[model samples]
Target: MAARTRAIVPDRSAGIKPLNYNFEVKPPAFITFEGLDGCGKTTQIERLAGYLRSRGEPVMVTREPGGTGIGERIREVVLGQQPAPAAELALMCASRAQSVEEIIRPGLAAGAWVLCDRFHDATEAYQGGGRGFDREAIAALHRVLCGDLQPNLTLILDLDPRLALARARRLPAASRFEAESEVFFARVAAVYREIAAREPWRCRLIPAEGTIDEVAGRVREAVDDVD
Candidate 1:
């Protein structure tokens, strides 16, 4: 939820999946929702998107590791059972760069309330923290390549590490990130907490270890706030 303001070209919105750092914005700022693989991010995104749409607010629902045409291809490559961690993270970042440019930035610019399932913070938490990469390195990539285009609002759904992994196992395998072990996801939750602690004003943590509607209620309240 590193909110910042920057001007952009009015009609240069591209599609999702930019590998290079060359981005010219065309959308308004956005709200992003992020968490571990099965902490109800997708369900919450759908509910939030529906809620905002009902209010006549423009909303865009999207996800990372695969958002655009090219990104979906990368998604397949990155999700293999034995993909290298660096390779996986690199591909994920590649997908995100384009998603930010094409779907996120442009949608935000067009006054649509962009609601993403995951963002760069996923990179920091999973790739850096859970996977044992350097936090400074992850931050450096976002700070440099992404500039100041952080989420206007971020809802980090936190659940007990073991419980999250257990639930995740019950669901269909979504991506490479979803295949990590319980201890790995536990580490991710810890990192997410650290993130919220560091950015209290920007993040609202919800106990995502409950019924769908119950968790969704928390998600709505968090997004209903004014930044």
Candidate 2:
């Protein structure tokens, strides 16, 4: 896999040194953005995508449970209404399996920068934390479905679920997960923190309580710091 990294160049001609970005070199192929609902994952994803595209990188922006034709239908089933915990887990993994085989894997193989909104960690957090499902079982399912494919970098927007839920409520048509109780969202955020702490190499936890531009700056810094 190629590493499509962005480089910085200084402009000496300008009175003030202007920073120029170059995206010619390969950095990491797969990058994922994750957070509780209304943590600004979608906004940041779009901003990052636009930045990368402006630099001439081939970027593929997609999301879990809805990246593929079959996956979108599964997304409706999973988010439109509640289902059994086990059923929800199965459906999530099933959709992910299709997404990996049909969309994400190919995008990476073709040397496109793949940006996903959420991935397997979502299952670990939602099912394992929010729903109190088995972690080992979820890990096993992730292994079988994803199979050696992992994000090169995962940006977690960490924030208080109370504030996050309030923001989510302002949006129309909340998903089943978004409608979860405060206790559930707290558990989900806790699991996300746990994963980021455990896998520091691949995960960067960013405080999401700041303004959009401030958070976006941190997001860029995290990507720029990836080595």
Candidate 3:
């Protein structure tokens, strides 16, 4: 796969060469990473950003919910378990809108490769797919807030629900989604898989059953491969 990953340059204007390819550009690429709880999304995002920086590509390590100043406040409310599901999803959508407007769009415009930990996929998995909310409703709100700025490439860390739940429980503090029941996690995992199947062009499923470094290697391919 690494050998095959040698083909994804952005072009003459973008100045992106092949993998291990180092070139400068006026504006960098935008990629987002997503996965269920304990699927190592954060770890992989951090590793990818670090690797890009090591290669001398300007990289921005950002996250949804709390990427910007206003977003951090909304993150506390939406993921804190107090808000109703509908209300929480609203907050999340608003926060994501703000993030895209304030952090992501500008960073992409500035030629800094933006690596996001979680993007719109969380809403799909959690609120729409997990909580049984109206997909049309969420989609409409998202449209109004974000205007269809989906991630260019989304790498979903697919893992067994049981394993992910167990790992999540070991964490000292977790968000509302992480504290969901095992059955709920099973449902969410199903949704994540469904999305991956439905959107093969934008979504790539990487087995999340390995060590952190192993998972990061997969993420590196997703970003560097570009296709």
Candidate maximizing TM-score: 2
Mind giving the per-residue lDDT tens digits that candidate 3 earns over 52-104? 88988788877878889998998887767589877888888888888888988
The CA-based lDDT of model 2 is what?
Answer: 0.81
Question: For model 1, what is the alpha-carbon lDDT of residue 86?
Answer: 84
The runs of at least 3 residues in candidate 3 whose Cα sits more than 4 Å from the true structure, single-residue gaps closed, are: 1-27
Q: In model 2, how many backbone clashes occur? A: 6
Expressed as tens digits, the lDDT of each residue in 1-227 for candidate 2 is: 23444333433331222212233325437888998998999999998888788888889988987899999999999999778889998998999899899989888788888899999888888888898988767877787667767787889999999999999988887787777899999999999998777666567999998898999889988877763
List CA RMSD, all candidates: 7.7, 10.2, 7.5
> Candidate 2 — which residues are off by over 4 angstroms?
1-28
What's the number of clashes in each of the models? 10, 6, 2
CA lDDT, candidate 3, residue 6: 26
Better of 1 and 3 by lDDT: 3
Q: Which should have the higher lDDT, number 1 or number 2?
A: 2
* Clash-forming residue pairs, model 2: 3-26, 3-27, 4-26, 4-27, 5-26, 5-27
TM-score of candidate 1 versus the correct structure, residues matched by position: 0.84
- Candidate 1, residue 108: the lDDT equals 70
Cα lDDT listed for each candidate: 0.73, 0.81, 0.74
